[model samples]
Target: MADLSKDYMSNSADPKNIQDLTTFVQNLMQQMQDKFQQMSDQIITRIDDMGNRIDDLEKNIADLMTQAGVDEHV
Candidate 1:
């Protein structure tokens, strides 16, 4: 519909147009940064969760080996 590329590439020499474009770009950047931060946080949380699960599994295996009288060296 609207020519977004033209609007973005238009000259920003006019005071009003410059202010508006600056505000728009700043808002867009902030929103993208926020989304990226959220995704990063989620990934970190999932990684931590997986680490905990792996640790639990390791401990459980150790316990099972001890109960079964398996040699630690083996």
Candidate 2:
């Protein structure tokens, strides 16, 4: 069989091929970063919404306690 390594080296030596490979890698990295950023944003939004819901629940519970004439410090 012919020297496959030599053939690969020759093909890889072409500047256009190198540029194309670099561009492909950069684009792939950017896509992955974008996906990660989107996921992070969604996680943060969900956490904030959960915090709001917890706060509302706490407020409602406090209101119920007051209606029953219970002291808050008790």
Candidate 3:
């Protein structure tokens, strides 16, 4: 992996400047990570919702088949 800290520090030679740059990059990365996690959670919730919908549809189909007298033995 690339040395992200060094790269983000703009190759600063001064110790204090490098430290400030490092902090800035770290905070920015943390914010991005939080946003990504939120998005992932939302996607998972949506997938679970879709799965529930599919289960309901399956039950409806089974009920319809029963009412139509489709052979249960099959």
Write candidate 1's Cα lDDT for 5-68 as tens digits.
Answer: 6666665566889899899999999999999999999999999999999999999999999999
Badly placed stretches (over 4 Å) of model 2 are 2-4
List the candidates ranked by lDDT, beginning with the highest: 2, 3, 1
Q: lDDT score, residue 70, model 2? A: 97
Off by over 4 Å in 1: 1-12
Residues forming the 10-long window of minimal summed lDDT in candidate 1: 5-14
Give model 3's TM-score versus the native structure.
Answer: 0.73
For candidate 3, the lDDT comes to 0.91
Candidate 3 least-lDDT 10 residues: 1-10
lDDT of 3 by residue, 1-74 (tens): 36888786665767888899899999999999999999999999999999999999989988989999997668
Which residue segments of model 3 deviate by more than 4 Å? 1-12, 72-74
Between prediction 1 and prediction 3, the one with superior TM-score is: 1
Task: State which candidate has the highest TM-score.
Answer: 2
Task: For each candidate, give its TM-score against the true structure.
Answer: 0.79, 0.89, 0.73
How many clashes show up in model 2? Answer: 0
Counted clashes in each candidate structure: 0, 0, 0
RMSD of each: 5.7, 1.3, 7.6
Tens digits of per-residue lDDT for model 2, 1-74: 37998888899999999999999999999999999999999999999999999999999999999999999999
Q: Name the Cα RMSD for model 3.
A: 7.6
